[model samples]
Target: MLPPPLNHTSSILVIGAGTWGCSTALHLARRGYKNVTVLDPYGVPSPIAAGNDVNKIMEHKELRDSNPDARSIAFATCTRAALNGWKNDPVFMPFFHETGVIVSGSTPDLIRHIEKDEIDSSKGDFITLKTAQDFRNTMPPGVLTGDFPGWKGWFSKEGAGWIHAQKAMLSAHREAKRLGVKFVVDDPTGNVVGLIYQNGDVTGAKTADGTVHRADQVILAAGAGSDRLLDFKKQLRPTAWTLSHIRMTPEEAKRYRDLPVLFNIAKGFFMEPDEDNHELKICDEHPGYCNFIPDPNHPGEKRSLPFAKHQIPLEAEARARDFLRDTMPHLADRPFSFARICWDADTPDRAFLIDRHPEHPSLLIAVGGSGNGAMQMPTIGGFISDALEGKLQKELKYVVRWRPETAVDRDWHSTQNRFGGPDKVMDFQDVKENEWTRINETEKSKKSI
Candidate 1:
């Protein structure tokens, strides 16, 4: 009812401060947008947010091994440019590491895509590993092979690699604050109850304390939490992932110190060695958690953003255990240091969903990471900003539009998300944190897939 807070000139409000939210805010500030404000329940880069991991892969190569690999290759190239451009900036340069990545299980389609992109390893961008030994050589003495016995893949982008999650967010966050962009954790003011709608336009948002901050434009980048607020529950679903970590011996640590991230797309899991923790982290990329989570604040708001369960579920543990035993046998018996469920937003087609609310002219939506949001750290904000300014490129324009279904195959996003694989964990809540160690001790001590 109060006059809209944002004026006609250009006042912006970005909801859900995760990867895209923070990046958009920082970029907007950099562009000299004076009234950029970000509101988040857990603050930008919430420790629990999907992008807040210790390390996430930043590969530009296509792992799906399909014709779409061509499109993915192009996407990767653009992402690489964005990352390289930002790494030179003193603020963000520190957070990114160019340790490189190794991707096995490349299909003929993947190779063709590489050819289409004119990619050649001799250019110092990638190395084609022809056999199991070649792949294992990149890893510790005896890791990988068996189910992937004849697997041949590429280990490329010597200067392309993973990201230090918190640092990336912190750097951008600091820059945004320095530029006079306001960032607030919803706790102090109030969590966003809903948007302010007047005259058939989204004017602003109202908080629990009965405060209304009007805005001329609102960007919803809440990730998994956007559905309830924006009324897109069917199109977007909050998904879960399990990340399990294991400590390594000094020798194991030394050997893996410079290891590239290992992603066996055909096999359904990805591995990341944490140099700082002297540990190895692995997770299930396919068949992600489809379970529902409760939203404490919005009761009856079924399927709110799922919480990270402390315990690593049995179904995930099996593949994880097999990966260690068959791929890295020596690490098979190591005790798990910790495990957690990482909740992220997934769209119907698994592609990104960044569009304006059909009914509200002032409301912009940027949700649905499909589990690949982290790598976009370099340019997601720019994409969202370009969309907001009506400057998106032809290819990227559709990615930001609202669509009930993607024309492509359902498996289109499976390459990046690797969702809907063989393994099925019918009950999402089958495991709890309290019995995590106990489950490890009793069940999966001597298992291999």
Candidate 2:
């Protein structure tokens, strides 16, 4: 006599069809889960979601020289494999362009790492140059100038580059839908307004128009808006990056046409060339705009994002001009075609949280990109799926725990990209009187409640 066969028909509900949720859906389908569903206010590729960005860097390797023995480096080794998987797959490879990544002003150790990677992996090839003459002969004569006085850098031409994130995510969503994963967005049941729970267990969710959507488990990968749906407000702080694009004349674009993606470590900026090789996109990569929409019903609570009408503040605009002056002076005088904020759901250690809810084991949350989550799109899905199946590996699970500290936020934001003006940043907290203080006070109130 054998015990009753285990029931394997539990349904799963996912909120937000953004990167994490969509990726999770794909991996769940791959794992043979027949009833995985994703819910979002807007359909796949929310126009305002950070994953909808034009481009994002896919770091070929982890270059952390500060701690030589860190486990993160090994973790990156695994992630790099997943990146290569995407690059090899025909359907997905188109979105991941391995044009190359250039890191500047880095230490001697990083240069050595690049050198070693060149030899070990055929995907990465290294290039190093020194002196002004070397710059003229090897790269565009004025690309690395007096702005970066004491910086020596290297490039990995293989296995590193940028991804057309928006297209890739939409494709992944389509693939997941094709493979039996359910996606609910812009639906008549209305947008999810709350979580449904019973007997101290999270069983499902509720929609804005008072409809209930039940599931055995729920994964909330709503990006920065996670705080609005769940009580991880203290753990996940939503943030955005400052992105600028200079309208280059044809001659100017041709001059920099083949320039590789660049990282000016000391100056705190990076440049991502568009696919057409016409527009050059630059970002300070510093504490970007941490803007939010104040939740009307939940006074003092906020959702991190740009609604359709969000605008980039004036100081951030000025900072872009200053960054251009410091990095590419020729382009500094050119008119900027666009400047905007790219939101990210950040965690304390700059790591992400992907685990069961602290209070409800039946519910899971995946937020906290810390501005660098998009690149991991190819692999994060598997991790989320594994977590849901109680089979997530030990190494990453350790790093993605539910630890929250406010000091990290302060320290992370302290290194302001002043550019030139002393009062240069006009993030949400700065533009609105008492906005920053309001968040802190609100968090305190939540703790009390």
Candidate 3:
């Protein structure tokens, strides 16, 4: 049976003040949903949220799924809306840098997808660049001095670049607050421990401090930490990817500032440096990592969990160095400012999980970022709110619907469209003593959380 429809005065509690949570609150408020409360361990731009970063790639045509499904097509539509918002929305425009994007060295399948997109939707904006010089010609004269070698792919001049991620998230949080969305950021009260149930229906959430924040509806948007609170029946696996930053001088930042976002599926990708901090961020493209810890909800079962740490694996650092040496050799040997392993919940098909719980009528789940969540930020909430209102389009509803049947066992490793990284998922604790990029004294002493 369907739960009662939510009204504006209904008490709506959103857990995890991360990207999806904040976006949902903002959209809900904009839609006149009053009495909405958001709970999190921190305020806007939570340290744990994957979107909380120096910058992230803006929307681009090359990142679309090769064999598009109904869900992929729906997300593509969302990407169109997101591009419009990034270009015109006052809240997000200032942070979007439309420097265009050059995708190179991708797998054969992705290359085919690029070729197809060029023919189907380029409209003269998306075209092929077959050589390293071809890639460099797109940027100003002084940027991208690397030996492009095997780098050859497509480029699109419209609706692509990087966005100041942290600032964008903060902007959303502020707007949501201005719309009268209440936020709780204190520990115990903000730290959600579990859900409160009444007669088999979720009635509220219990925080770490023994307080139960009752609500008429509860939405779980806790990116990777969802498994710790409730069992998703092996549908969601917490996985992580590593990213590092290179500190650059003011002049260097300026020289490289106009470079289009450089991406290589097999090697890695990097974007312009932070204008103020001048920290050039680079991420190693990989299948992602898994850290198996005891599942809190299921006492005897062990599931992959995310461990918040600043140190990254030594192999990850090596990969980053290799990418830099090949692309921007000047900064290849530069010591990293720091590194982090960002975590996200992985669904088997890389599609999002956004549907009401089959058994718990009062609960809704909105997660499974699968590394594509950041680009959909501007419009993802609309889908969630529509789903909550029982008005989501039929095509998308099935894509994000709750389906435990797709759940794989603990031995499952993601092989879907992943090109780089090792075939097997690396266990967090499997790294030996010296196999970590321990940058500082604090990082060296911190073994595990």
Candidate 4:
């Protein structure tokens, strides 16, 4: 079925070209929006790398423990749907891998959670491992299984996998270009104005370059830089999360060559084999000690290390190596090749703020994916498009009505009031510039409570 026609001639401006921005822009293009403009400080092949490894099978413990937001569940549902769409699409076939994912945790509660969620056992045609010995015998010899408390495994031959993020972004951009979506590489300096108000309502944004870009509505898919574009500072918090990919040597690869995307719940670390790059990609559940601090008014030059002081280069690398040694004893002494770090924007609730601004009803804020943005991109895009076009109001009904004040009730950790209030107008000066350092300091002093 064809997407509904855009109610008006809308020129949507996407602020960032990261996965979220690119995905949202592509969704708009797919919906037949012609005057869409995606603006990113960086050009194609964004510095951020994409991981298609589905660690949901393994990371269930972390999500339940650390993330209690219902939005995460909603995001997961959408992500699963998006994966299904990609798996069925001929063009996206080559980009997705269906290796299936495996989870091994030390807690029975974790196992029960997985089973209860119906994600524990694979519904697909794949062998299930009932014991540690069975898993070791089924795959490589040296793989570690002692850390897991019980032997519960799930293998879905049809479960969704990760995508090559850069490739997918490129594909979406290419398609957007074909659909006549304009590209802007510059950052917005002043407040964006110019919306076609029919009977007192905003229609779109007009760029500083005097471009009268009109639209029936606007969607904000800006990543970490989202707080700068709209007046919802208090409602949306963009925390910086860092992930380091520790490259394993050939000898280390030999030890875990056949290991399925393994989730080590005991240590809060996950590993996946990168067949194309011939390296084992590892990431931990430990949240990085950094916060995003970008100035929208006078945005500075981009930095290779966008993280805060807590994320020291040497210290982070050492942590990654130590984590690998502890989790996978087979590769303890192997020499690490290299490591790359990237930032993820998180919200206060740890769930995505995927709704419209309370006051600025015309503006939709798509920031704060926490770390699940890439996984849920396509669904998010579809939902945003549907919300704007008014086709799926019940689906996005919570988005418009939800408020940031009841964040803790929504499973978010309560903190100081950042955004002034619902009715307060947010400007460039109102942003908490040094908020990251303060948050880091606070975390260091407190125990893991």
Candidate 5:
């Protein structure tokens, strides 16, 4: 059942100031909602949030799914809405870079699937890249110097690019603040510990310092950590992917300045280098890792928690190297300047979980990013706000509705784009000292949670 409808003057308490949380605050304020408070362990653009990165892939096109199912259609619609916001919204324009994207893979079936998708979607500008030379033709002669052996994919300038992630979050934070959203960022005050319930209804949240903040409605947008606050009964599986950055010289960065984002299913992906720092980020393709520990809230049960360690597993580094070796051999051996694991809250079906708690009516669950939170930042807040107002579009509400029954028997294998199962996802406990990359002095100074 949906929670009661909210009013303009309702006291809303939002936990977690990550991408989704800040967006929720901004959208609520835009809709004339008064008295909204956002609490987080860190300030806007929290260093630990997955979206608080140098850059992230953005989809701008209206690519329809081949299957045309309701869930896939919902995803496509939401992405189009977000792209619209990114293109026209003043707060997001400065951070968007529509440099285009190249989706390449060595698998034959995957390649054919992509080809069919382009044809069925009726995208006229999609460029087919069948050979290494073909892939390089998209960029200048000097760029993509590596031999893209056996690479088969397509390039589209119509609806793909990357965004300045951290900066975007900062901008949204500033905009939300401009609209009078209160932010509690201090350690004890922002570190929410539990929900405050009365008469079988949630009324507020209690922080680490024992500060109980009362509210007419409470929104849980904690991203990966949402499961820790309240058990979703396995509806949310906390997972993490690995990312590393290669530092390049100013001249080297200039050569690759406007290069499109490159993605290969079997290897990895990389976007344009950061203009200011000249660091090109890359990530390996594989099933994300899970860090399971005894649940503090539920002593006898285990939970997957987000680990903020700056160093990544050696295997992750090796995969990144393999991707670079195949596409950009010159930089394959170059040691990473920095590396870290980005956490995400994944649902079994990869759709978002944005509905009210069936038991606790006043508490709303607005999580399940499934690694697509960055792209949805622009319009996710509107979806969340609509849910609170009891007017969310039927398509979106239907896909994101709360359902514990589906959680009982999760089939991670059915999740799209994921390649492996439990055997592939490395457990945090199994990572040995030798398996971890050396942490530099800069990263050493930063403490892990």
Candidate 6:
């Protein structure tokens, strides 16, 4: 027999209906929290922007770089959980491809890391290549032939793969609805007090039409728009990333159709096969060009866009074309058909911020996933659920500690000690005044208990 649901009036309000927000809502619901609500001013899964596309490419770049030291065990744990969820859920299965992933770079160390055997293969396959020829061999016919000079990386047969982002989001939304989570589309005008808060705790969000609802807790997974909900005017920064769907001609598609996701480390270009559509989704890992535009609500508030200039660098396109030609020689002259962009919220250290608010303990903030949010959505939501319930797993504990602030403090103290600075020593009093330090301590206490 299953445990009885927690009989409480504490409803949970989740802001943003995108992948992260929706996923969080779904996870909470699965955990027996019935009164969960999701809010997004723009409605479910906001339109994909150029910035979002580029950030996706950069995420693959990070995987290729494979800084094991930088790996967030929390993220990995969540990714595993999400993968398991998809594997068990019939609705999400079709959207996921088990074709596996391949990574190629110039550095042997990078290749070794990419192909590391000890890495978790439960999500998918992983392989590393010692030579360019080894990398060439993995591709289907017309993929590679010439002596491409680069280190090679390959995915294991059981390695992680990609999902159609829009499709996955839609499925999650459908699932959330099926599980009885309510979605409210509204512009709250920044009046979060009566709408989402009741007696200093999350009740339920009020719609713009003035209908008041109550909930047990409120979760902030609003992505870039999180700042608006939390009044984090200066704390959050919205960044843009780009992605391009280049349709290869029949001949090109025929030659490279079977290629798994490919990351060319030397040129910083990555390509994935959109099998059903016969398009080669390509993008670069570089930050690309960005511009800051004003936010309508705040006078000085600005959001960044990857294609504010609306220009694609010729050099970047050439590099992508060259990679395709060298890696899969069949589509050398194939013209690209279409492309799109998206955005992501990035912290200074590029780590996600997933913890309860310092002042607003009832409000959980789950944004700033940077680019890896989509890939790690399932696991992230599960961990959030764990944290909220005060039952954080060991893996989640690792991620909580890896927050940018904690990492920065650790580095700062190490540097201070290295320099023999007497004044650099920190005390509990100093730590108590620091918000991040307090968060870390809270996490520590939670783990201890």
Candidate 1, TM-score vs. the true structure? 0.80
Tens-digit per-residue lDDT, 196-294, candidate 4: 334444445555665555554566665655555554434554443223443555776566554556544333444455544555555543434333245
Encode model 3's per-residue lDDT on 300-351: one tens digit a residue: 8778878777778989998988888767787889888768889898888788
Candidate No. with top lDDT? 5
Q: Which stretches of candidate 5 lie over 4 Å from their true place?
A: 1-5, 60-67, 116-121, 294-301, 411-416, 420-423, 443-449
Best-to-worst lDDT order: 5, 3, 1, 2, 6, 4
**lDDT at residue 233 of model 5 (Cα atoms):** 80
Write model 1 residue lDDT over 299-341, tens digit each, in one string: 8543535664546776566667766554676666777766777
| 325-364: candidate 2 lDDT, tens digit per residue | 6556666666555555566776666667888876788888
- Residue 96 local lDDT, model 4: 61
Worst 10 residues of 3 by lDDT: 440-449
Count of clashing pairs, candidate 4? 9
Candidate 1 vs candidate 5: the TM-score winner is 5
User: Lowest lDDT 10-mer window, candidate 5?
Assistant: 414-423
Residue 144 of model 6: what lDDT? 63
- Report the C-alpha lDDT of model 5 over 92-178, residue by residue, as the tens digit: 888888988887777677567656653333654677888888878888776677877767877878667899888888888999999
TM-score of each: 0.80, 0.78, 0.92, 0.68, 0.93, 0.69
lDDT of 6 by residue, 318-338 (tens): 555666565545554555444
Residue 200 Cα positional deviation in candidate 2, in Å, after optimal superposition: 0.9
Q: What is the full ranking by TM-score, best candidate first?
A: 5, 3, 1, 2, 6, 4
Q: Considering only N, C-alpha and C atoms within 3 Å, which residue pairs clash in candidate 1?
A: 5-214, 144-327, 287-420
Residue 342's lDDT within candidate 6 is: 48
